[model samples]
Target: MAISSLQEHPGSEVTVWMADGIYPISEPLVFGPRELGEEGTLVFKAQQDAQPVISGGVEISGWIKNSEGLWEAALPKELDETSGFRELFISGKRAARARFPNEGYLRVKQAGVDRRTNFYFQKGDFPIPVNLEGVELVFLHDWSISRIGIQEIDTAADQLIAVDSIGARIPAFFTIDNWEPHPRYFLENAPEFLDADYEWIFLKSQNKVLLKLPQNVNPTNSKVSIPFSQGLIVVEGEENYPVKNIHFEGITFQYSKWEIPEKGYSGIQACHFDPRPSNEGWAVVPAAIISIWSENITFTDCNFRNLGGSGIWFGPGSKNCKIIDSSLKDIAGNGIMIGEGQDRIVNGQPWWKSAPEQVASGNVVENSTISQVGSQFYGAVGIWCGLTAQTAIKNNVLFDLPYTGISVGWMWSPEATPARENIISGNHIHEIMNILSDGGGIYLLGLQPESKVLDNRIHGVKVNAGRAESNGMFLDEGITGVLVEGNLVYDIAKSPLRFHRATTNLVRGNFFFSDDSNPPIRYNTTDEEAIEKVDNLFFSEGEPSYQKELSHAISRWEKKQRKKRKR
Candidate 1:
């Protein structure tokens, strides 16, 4: 094998030339230390003037009309139902699964948990059929959403019993009107609910699919596909013999799935699927390109879209890697992640352990665009770093995400040993936190001394459902000795900048614009001496270049406050 050959000659060079077509991968492509080819020269690239795509999808055809004028097709026998694929694509566009009450969400009147993992709803609230078993119950909380499976529907007693997840647990206060049942939720994957155009449903047990195609779209003429692979690529190396010199260029990766956790999903802040809790409320999130304990690996001018998890993760011990000039869009989780969550914390202290090479250092993700992430995870960011040190994320455009745009540091404490000297600059992050609240476009946590956020532009934050706040740059608890400068921020539901227990940071030369009634800065319990320098405290003040619209909004708010006082 080429891999064995490469391992035989540790520092040799090899190239994989890919043709210009989609390669549907049913299994993951793993590159371990055995695949490394010395120094940093092993390359995986598309052929000259060719565009190659590595896909996790398999196309379906051979459609015929059913008696009811709907289209039907039999799935390949080799494809099993236990794969847990919930995503389907048609003609390269995502298709909606058959869902009940398509236009509006049904109100959940009253719900209570019971034995066998059952959820009892108020009688007469549910109108779906009793045979609608195996459907997904999509539940939404403050910033968390989960899709649970249905085992039985009791129409007469107004109760739906969920599939038993043995050790699943929920927060005691996460009950109806406490965690608070969202007023809107709908069920999915019932063929009887396939009433709308472009909707689809899979007969899992029968290995068949039913579809309602749009006008002028024939099933054979269009492409219908399902994502079967949960992970498409994995690069693993060891502490002493880390994989080196691996590169991927001009390739497109598409359509991977995230498995529904067997232990049942729990609510993590930011809608991340931390299925089970470890100590300190931490959970694990996975990505498609998961590289562990590797070095000098790179991906350039690539595309990652329609994926089910994070795009690429250079995990603990990965060093000097690069992801540049790429696009990661329409993904369900974070775009790119550096380091691991467990490495970010240990017993409430900064974790600086190095046994398995548990530190991501000197990685670079630059000049790329990532958007529409957290489509399913709801709490994922475009770029995330956890306990990573000396990393650089620059010149990236992050937009249309459900939560934070760029997030660094995960320790949630001021212990500065875990992460340090990171650079986050020259990124355009906007139109984020579109769903979850209590987040910022550029959010920082823990104590990453000398880490900097510079020259970034952020805006377009809105509150949804919960009372949690959303901002442009949120420096959360345990932050210290970082630089925040030259960022243009505005249009936030909360203050443009908020610091909670952050200290010894430099906040200078940054512009802040907001329609919020609160001050430009929300400093809660943070020492007044925390910010070493507050020069240009606010943007363009008292100069001819002062923003007229901002001054006018402030004057209007002042007048309204005065009127309220007089009344």
Candidate 2:
């Protein structure tokens, strides 16, 4: 009623103050152009010295100890099959889903007769669970992960069949020894797999949750929460009429959920999935807070945590927006995503036909912290930007992720798009690419002209068990006209800088230190003359041997690429 009245009356500026309390919403609060009026500015902020919470979770009570000694709780009758959630929180901490083996993963012994959707497990990997309902098999491929329901367990053949095709459209990403030497997998959301503490499983048929808490921790004394809503807030506008000058401050958004699609999740990189058997379209995991066709929107001093998917997204037709002094952590997918894919081009067309107003540009994210993302999706990144221009990301700390920390650009061809002149500077990225390979602290791709990556401190990139190597910076296919300067990258298992099919990039004034046996730079099937290296200081074991090692590395990489192409 208050908002509708405000839309009717013409006001230059409006402010809504939120008190210190938990505000739970069943659906996303949507704000459109009508809410902003012409030349109007709307602000939603917390009261001074107060903290306001917007939550999408429902509190779960009425716990009872089953005869098996596990605590069970009946979910609300309002929640049905569509309300199935992937995460649970107990007293402000995330609880793990019931997974087999307790630690590490089980390797695929062989590719099944039809390798796309089934794989043979090694002997004694797992026993058939008492119930197969709601059971999912999580497959860890080279650069992506796939989750699918099990169709059958052929114990006699030692094979497992998935309900759908696993991983991306490529066959090498699913079968073992094709792209990756050994594909690892695990079983999830089965009662027989719940062996450790802080584990939970949801039975959809019974509409209940079974939890195994830590020793001597009673469920009656703990507060349990299940995320029920998919999106918390959505700001939308049309092409000509946009939502303008809306600001949010000092608020916390939490506990939004994400559900797997009916066909299953066939992940590509950066939380994007191929959602069809025919590989028709590419889709991304949804964000809890989304702003599209909007301008001059700002989120300052806010918090986003315990989210089942990405935290915030500024999609197509967003411009001059800012996210400053915020914190995003414990998210199941990417912390933030800016812009949309070329396949799903919105509010704009190809560069030759795109209008300046239709492009998402001039966005900024500064002075913030992002950590502990990709909790469930291993292929997710900390921050992902696609087909956007002049996006500035500065002075942020990103760490503790499963894959890349920051990913910019999406197209893999040199054909022109809307991406250009973006800047990533002074960010501290570390401890990323922890579980996945073929990525880095900063991964850049495609034809983003004159983009700059400057003065970033990146370290602690470790080796992984996947096919490709992990690096401090990975410049992948069709990268053109990018400048990498004054960055400090060290302690990487692979080369500090790896270029694959990249062209016309400049690396200068950067300090690269390494303790690994690999060279400081790697050229994988890329022309050496394409990237100009000027005045870069390279140190290995306290000596400068980049010139000698780079020559050897190029030869080895070329030979390896030859063999891979033949395969």
Candidate 3:
């Protein structure tokens, strides 16, 4: 149904209530400014106590076991392979694509011999059988990941060659940083690599899918789905006329997928998912929900899982949006974001300084749970805001990711902008930067005046031996006038708080503890003219407060087991 089809009655309202079932949409459901009713509000909500699912996938049924003992299902021949399907879900759970060694990754012997497109394996790393034709190598370095397709495998030399497009784009992957002989990559999505029961693979040319069923499990007992849509909903309003007063409640969105570029893959900031060999500059990947040039939107009591890119993106010019009491799990990128547009830096000046950046402001993400994000791209965060102002991220739970939990600001310099006057408080964050390093539970960048980090609980940041250490809160490059107060951070690898070139900030009433003998804070600069610390802060005294620290600083996983035993 088109938004123009909505009847407009003067001084009246409109509500489109959905029922409890799955509504799979192949194309993006776009809402423009005309969607506004006569009373200027539109509510696309689920019926009370009903769970409506708006999915971006199709159900695949009629499964039978092949002669080779793998579950085989016929796929639709009409399904487009140009933008291939990359994710699979069975019985409401995500299943991993076929991979080898089952548990850990294989070490690399060499990045390549003066080449940017090949990786040589260690002596026992690339066995003859597992190094096959269609296998992909998923590389994990400091704060970035890339999934590159294998073009050729030389069993004689234990080397795998990639397509012409592997590392040509990102400077980190091809041109600059090197990851020679690191145990940071794993091979995925190959038949030879499918040793586990929960693993699956798809062959588009054959119009078939293959899976190894777990013991006592069969395809008949599962509801398998393959993602085919990149975006489920898009709200794009015109420049001056904005879509306003829209709300979504009690809806579940699942199974959106990302396809690798034909020229292979590279890494960019926020782990850009666009395939780029032919295309030069950065392009924004689609999300499950995107709002651009809109206002006064709310998404409450919703569930988002098995996603490809970001769960929700409030693009530039979008403001006054709320996402509350929601859950985002197993996502490929950020859980929620605002003000993600193009950024260009040249000759020590940003493009926004000259072009007058469009900032999304007054967004709130509160009382929500965001976990297992940055699944495909480990460089993103749970809640990310760039050039956004007056955003409040409070009372939330963020965990089980590779990178930072909440990231604010885009610029790295001290130039003032609207990305300030934000508040981050009353949140519980743990188990962060599990794969990627050089991040923290909460990370702030650039200049954000009147921004405050208050009353949050953070812990469980371990060191990734080869990468830069992790922290609880990081004020990086040109942070000024931000207030840090009443935060409890403990059990981390390094200092709980670190500031780089930070100046004139109020840091007080924050509790800090670490398992090792390092200080609770690391001030990277001697520019005392810029920062204020050592005031009203409590470190682990190893005596009176140590017992209190045990319960507060205890890991959440251990805490859960203790509660279970008590019951």
Candidate 4:
């Protein structure tokens, strides 16, 4: 059969034939406004009757619209002994067991519809029961099949062949065209463009321009800006080259070892390093217009939304970097994560081993909002600081997360030097429930360096009552220097704040009200020592002056702690 582009038109009639002598009429395949083709009709017909056409692995070569409104080319169709193309010909009925082959992998073009189509055999339609272990699906385009599953290829006939590999069993589907590879260039033997004293170099590919900086690279005098026209620029570095720059205006960066598994390319990442001496001082810097990273640099005013892994990430050598004014939504992974590198691999250990040593210190995130994230088990967070130190988070809004609104420490040990010093303050957090093992508003476990929870609002947090426990905030073992103050907690199924062996933590001046009649606030210590019920104005309109005084005292204590650290 010759490959033909299928077009669907409204009210037009066409015929589709199956090997079982069944015939189905044509139907309209609508391609919406976002699709490439104009609305048209598609007709399918069975080949010869004796041929008993078994399109076991037929792939669509280009973009095709399925019966559904969604524009997708890659699908695995199912056919029975009586199912061959005959089943697809039944008029006015949606065809079952239809598979689209895997078209070869391709790069996403800038602004055109680059699509491929393929077909596959559906499980449970085979002539006999066959174990599809190692079936390989071959394609004319350059493509690699990652995984496959048997949806229904069960057959009663003994003549059916068992698939060798999972890939071979995949029904043919159409794929988009492959992306064009970028041209390569060598930088060997190039003359030293700038003085050897400079530490960083900015290269623009379109103009073939290289901006070199002296060893004493300082933002006070020097600034770097690369135009957007530069298509694909490469930044080469020596083994121990130090980066010194403040701005990379209108430039998209491709890092050394960045890749997206499905997409196959690192989109864009812009970075700036601090040009300060003493590489060891602990001070919070002001918000800047660009992304910044120091030995302990900080990132503020950098909006990271609609991008992969949005928000600022501090590497291991990045000692103290803070990310603020940044919004990370519609991306994979939690927004604003701090710890070690994103892809640090330990030699003989799991990937999580390198997590502790990548300590991000004295980081502060304020006034940011993350929402509507699209992952099964990941989503938005007001702030996330794991395996780092002296981090302050305040006045942020996080909602509609698949996990928790604010996640403090995961697999982080307070015993480690410069533990994740997470301070969650004055934030409005809600809608934190989905995963079974999730802690709602704020989740802290293992060893926490120092966590301060103050003046926050938590509402509409859902956790299974009796069967599971969810809290407005949770504190676990090895937790030290925790302060929960002046926060409003309501509509939580479980305890508002549950602390397990959290030592030296203070909970004061917080309002806790629940319509469940009796409020639950479980702690290891008594109300007088562990929690100070001072000046807590509840919905009942009762005021507690003692709680108010304690809240003030806790605030004073935090201020003093900040000052003492500065000293």
Tell me the TM-score of each prediction against the true structure.
Answer: 0.86, 0.93, 0.90, 0.46
Error of 2 at 369 (Å): 0.6
Candidate No. with top TM-score: 2
lDDT of 4: 0.39
Write candidate 3's Cα lDDT for 1-567 as tens digits: 424445445334457899999998877888887665423566788998889999888878878887888898877554645455777888778788887667776766766765566767766664444434456777766666667787787877878777654444545444313543453677777777777887998776666789898768988787888887778888888657877777888889887867766665566556554446445456544578999888888899989998887889988778799999999998877888877533545345553564344568888998899999887777778988878888899889998988889988877788876677999987889999787777799998888899999878888888553446689998888898899987888778788988887778988877777554677777887375456665544566465777566566445434643563476
Residue 3 lDDT, candidate 3, scale 0-100: 46
Task: Give the better candidate number (3 or 4) by TM-score.
Answer: 3
Clashes of each: 3, 0, 3, 97
Off by over 4 Å in 1: 1-10, 37-40, 100-126, 151-184, 270-283, 343-357, 525-529, 537-567
Q: What TM-score quantifies how close candidate 3 is to the native fold? A: 0.90
Writing each residue's lDDT as its tens digit, candidate 1 over 295-393 gives 888999999988877788998789999999999988877889888665355456544753323578999998899988876677678888887889999
Runs of candidate 4 exceeding 4 Å displacement: 1-300, 308-311, 341-358, 379-382, 411-416, 434-437, 446-450, 463-467, 523-567
> What are the lDDT figures for the candidates, one per model?
0.74, 0.84, 0.76, 0.39
Q: Estimate, for each residue in 79-158, the C-alpha lDDT of model 2 and write its tens digit.
A: 76564888999886899999997888888888776678788877688868877888999888777888888998888888
Report the C-alpha lDDT of model 4 over 211-301, residue by residue, as the tens digit: 2233343322422211111111111111133222112111111101111122111111111111122122111111111121234233344
lDDT of 3: 0.76
Task: Report how far off residue 131 is in candidate 1 (Å).
Answer: 2.7
Clashing pairs in 1: 40-245, 270-379, 438-469
